[model samples]
Target: MPMKASGAADLTVVDRFDDGVGWIAYPDETMQRASHAVESDGQLWVIDPVDAEGVDDLFEEFAEVGGVVVLLDRHKRDAAAVANRHDVPVYVPEWMSGVEDDLDAPVKQMTDGVGDFAVDRLIDNPFWQEAVLFDGETLIVPEALGTVSYFCASGERVGIHPMLRALPPKKLRQYDTERLLVGHGEGLSEDVRQEVRGALSGARRKMIPLYLKNLRGALGI
Candidate 1:
């Protein structure tokens, strides 16, 4: 069974059985490709709501119990429709908009930088506040190679972010992770720093050849 985080129930990836490599069902998980769920402030929060009906089913069930939908960043793939349908307002990062629209029923514009989107907790680094929640436990996804992690009760955070450059000492101090929850990319784990190091190393190596390649042979010179 999926877990709950707050006064409400927390949904999680449970029972990935033979339904074509699918996880167990949330109340109506056909949408949001629903990944994880958590409880916060006496409300049930659902993350990454997919367009599928199963996701909707979960939302439908939760709506009756007062569940709040939060689309972290622009990841509002299927949250818009459901939010409108149930009259449940969806929360989004301020940097993004139109990401979730349910006929102007209600929407919370969120951002890590401005407005009510400001982070709900404190962090060692300023950038860490840029971290917002789609559904409380769910973190705002910045971008590919975007360093995001989980706010574990035991104080653990982890995620893979593309390392375009080395992080400052302050940012480095903020890195405390345990699992890489979700990403569009395939084959990545929660060991963020290590994964980023490897990706950065590869990205840097690719750039070297472009700067010093021989043009004569067009192969290797």
Candidate 2:
């Protein structure tokens, strides 16, 4: 909930967590610790009291001084497990609560459209308030979600995470994206990044109509 020291060049490393929430750790690649950072709503959030073995190091590096927030871009992943552990509220779009059917992990939700809610202090005002970052701040996102496809039994449909891993250049020209964080899959690798970005971008556009249709029928709308 506070600020991290001024190590401005640190890039959170994106790693896969079995639980599905994206993990980004301090720049230290040597850390084989149970560490993870999540990009929720738009702010950077890290998990504390990390797995038993790496608890001390993980906690030391993760302590914040101010202006930190936890964002949960997808409710389906059930991220509250980590959010609750840190005693932080989860960020979400206003439209999301209308459709985030999962209840177990629900926490305080907010969006860029809100008139007042400490929104700016908590997250970036633009980018759907998506992919927020601050000096010495860290963010983790499912940068690959947009490209990866999965079958959902409940909705009987598939949807994308809206942001995918990709090169900063091509992604900007192709999407005119509001803003997003790199969560998983091949970070800083131009070739792998571009491929994943293109795939996810294409998939997200395709999944929109389908997701809406399925959600509408489910809600009787």
Model 1, span 1-221: residue lDDT tens: 11211223233444122110112233332121334334344444444444443545543333242323443444555555656665666665454434445324476654442221224322223233223333222233333233222111111232223222234113322334333334232222356556544444444444333234323223435
Q: Each prediction's TM-score against the native?
A: 0.45, 0.36
Top TM-score prediction, candidate number: 1
**Tens digit per residue, CA lDDT, model 2, 1-221:** 11122233243434433221333333333221223443334433543212222322333343331112333333223244544545554445453433244534444454552111122222223342333332222222332222112211122222234332221223232332222334322222234334435444555444555566546655668
Instruction: Give lDDT: candidate 2, residue 96.
Output: 40
Question: For residue 76, what is the lDDT in candidate 1?
Answer: 50
**Least well predicted 10-residue stretch by lDDT in candidate 2:** 147-156
**lDDT, residue 150, model 2:** 24
Cα lDDT, all candidates: 0.36, 0.33
In model 2, the runs with Cα more than 4 Å from the true position are 1-44, 47-59, 65-75, 98-106, 113-186, 189-221
Worst 10 residues of 1 by lDDT: 147-156
Task: Judge candidate 1 against the unseen true structure and give its global Cα lDDT, from 0 to 1.
Answer: 0.36
